[model samples]
Target: MLTPKQARFVEEYLIDMNATRAAIRAGYSEKTANQQGPRLLEHAEIAAAIDAAKGARSERARIDALWVLQRLVFEAEADLADLFGDNGELLPVEAWPLIWRQGLVQGVEVLELFEGYGADRVHIGRLRKIKLDSRVKRIELIGKHIGVNAFRENVHHTGLDALGDRLERALKRNH
Candidate 1:
C-alpha cells in the first residue's frame, strides 16, 4: 500500500518515465525532487507498482516486443513499387495497400501545378510526392533488437596478429 503522495508519484511517473518530473508533479519539493524521485523508486512496493502499471498499459495498448518487431519487419519489407499503378503513375492513397498506408509512408506532398501567373494562371495537374520512412534504418533497428549486426562494420584483425608477425620477423633475423 502507498500513501496518496506515493500513489500520485507512481501515476505521474507513468506519464513520461521521468522520475524528477514525476516527483515534482507528485507534490514533492523541487529542491528535493531530484533525490526523492530515485529514492522513491528504490522501494520494493514502488518498483512493483511501476511494473504493474507498465504491464497494464502494455496490455491495454496491445503492444509488446513481438508487436514492435513485427512492425519493424513490415517497415523494412515495405516496397515502393506497391505505391505505383500499372502505368507507372503513383496510385491514390485510397488505392494503397493497408500495410503501405499505415506504416511505410511518412508523409505526402502535393504541389498543384499551374499555367501562367497570378490571375491569368490556369489550373494544371498536380505533382504528388510520397515520403517513405527509411527501410535501411528500420532494418538496422530490427537487427539491433535481434542481436544481428546488420549495419555494423566489423574489422577482423586483432592487434595481437600484428605483434605476432613482428615477433616472427625479429626471430628470423636473429636466426
Candidate 2:
C-alpha cells in the first residue's frame, strides 16, 4: 500500500509531465521527484498494487478510496491509533457503524436494482464499503477515461441516475 504522497507522485508522473513539477506537487523537496519517485517506483510490487487500486472502479464501490488511502498513509507513517482493535483494519471505531449502515443501504439498493442479478454476501460486502464517492467518481472519471471524446462530452445525468437508480433498486430489492 503506497502512502498518499507516493500515490500522488505516481499519478502525477504518469501524466507525462515534468518530473520536478510532479515531485514538488507531491510535497517532496528541491527537485526530488527524480530521486524520490524512482526509489519508490522501484518497489514494482507497490506500483502494481497502486495501479490495481487506482483503476476506474465505481464510486458505489470506491467512495472509500480516500479512507483506504488515508489508511495506507497511516500504515506508511506508522501512526495509526489502535482504534480498530487488534484486527488491524485502520479505520476509526466511531465511524464504522455509520459507514456500515450506509453500506447496507447501498447493498439493498444494488440487490433490488440488479433484481435479475445475484448478489452474494462477499459481493455485497465489497460493494458496501465502496465509498459514496466511488459512484460520483465513476461519473467524473468517465470523461478522463476517454481522451478527446471526453472534452466533447459532459455528464450531468450520471449523478442523477446513480441516486435515483440506487434508491429505486434498493426499494425494489426490499420486496
Candidate 3:
C-alpha cells in the first residue's frame, strides 16, 4: 500500500512529469523534494499508481494521441478580414466563435479621447491582434509522439558509434 504522501506525489507527478516539483506539491519539504521526487518514482507502488491513473484518465476522456493530433491540425481559423467591420473597426465580441475569440483577441484596451469639452471624454477602443498558435509546432509535437521526424536522417551515429570511434582513435595512437 502506498502512503498518503506517496499517493499525492504520484498524482502530482502525472500533472507535470517533474518529480521534484511533484514532491514539493505533495507537501514534501522543498529542500528534499529534489531528491524525494526521483526516489518516489523508483518505488513500485507509486509507479503502478501513476500508470493506473493515466489509464483511467485515457479511458474517461476517450481520446487517443491521434485524436489530439487531428484536433490540432484541424483548428480552422476564421478569415482575418472578416474580423473587422466596413469602418475597419473590430466587430462585437459575440460576432465570432468562442475559439476565434480566444485565439484572435490578444487584448482589449480602452483609450480616453478628449473632445472640445473640458470635463467630457469619449472612450476609444483598441484591440490588439495576436497570431494564432503555429501549426508547425503542433505538427512537430504530433510527429514526436508518432516517432517521426524530418531531421532524424541528419543524426548519423548512435551513442555506441561515438564510443567506438574514440576507442579506434586511442588504439591507433597507441600503435
Candidate 4:
C-alpha cells in the first residue's frame, strides 16, 4: 500500500510528468520536493501506482500518438464562416463536428451602441475563427515518423551503410 503523500505524488506526476513539481503538489516541503519526488518514483508501490494511473488515463481518453497524427492529418476541415451567421451571431455549437468543435471557437467582444447615447452594454461571447491545423506541418510530422528527414528532403539511413562508415572511420583512426 502506498502512503497518502506517495499516492498524491503519483497523481501529480501524471499531470505533466514533472517529478519535483509533483512532490511539491503532493504536500512535500518545497525545499525537499526536488529530491523527494525522484525518490518516491523509485519506490515499488509508488511506481506501480503511477503506471496504473497512466493506464487508466489512457483507457479513459483513448488518445495516443497515432490518434493525434490521424486527427491532424486526416480529419475534416472547418471554416470560420460556416460557424457564424451573417448578422455577426455565432451559430449553434451543434453545427460543428465532435472533434473540430473542441477548439472551433474564439470569443470576441461585440459592442452595442444606442442612438444619441455614449455606449450600450458590451456583449462578451464566443466568436468563430479559422482554427484549421496546418496540413503541411502534419504531413511533415508523418514524414518524420516514417524516418524521412524533412529538413534535407530525404530518408534517414541508419542501416548497414551508416554502421559501415563508422567502422571505416574508426579503422582509420586506429592506423
Model 2 over residues 136-170: C-alpha lDDT tens digits? 34434444444435445565655887899999999
Top candidate when judged by TM-score against the true structure: 1
What are the lDDT figures for the candidates, one per model? 0.92, 0.52, 0.76, 0.73
Tens digit per residue, CA lDDT, model 4, 1-175: 9878888889999999999999999999999988998999899999899988988898789977778767655543445466667886666667655655664343334444434434754554444444454556656777776667754465576688989999999999999
At residue 170, give the lDDT of candidate 4.
Answer: 100
* lDDT per residue (tens digit) for residues 77-120 in model 3: 34566667899886776875665665545555555454455566
The segments of candidate 2 whose C-alpha lies over 4 angstroms from its true place after superposition are 17-20, 53-175
- Which is the winner by TM-score between candidate 2 and candidate 3? 3
The Cα RMSD in angstroms, rounded to one decimal, for candidate 3 relative to the true structure is: 5.2
Candidate 1 lDDT by residue in tens digits, 1-175 = 9999999999999999999999999999999999999999998999999999999999999999899999999777767798899999999999998988886888999999999998999998899988887888888889888999767788887799889999999999999
lDDT for model 4 comes to: 0.73
Which regions of candidate 3 deviate over 4 angstroms? Answer: 25-30, 58-63, 76-90, 108-131, 145-148, 151-175
The CA lDDT at 117 in model 1 is 96
TM per candidate: 0.75, 0.26, 0.59, 0.50
Q: Which ten-residue region of model 1 has the weakest summed lDDT?
A: 149-158
Cα lDDT for residue 150, model 3?
Answer: 63
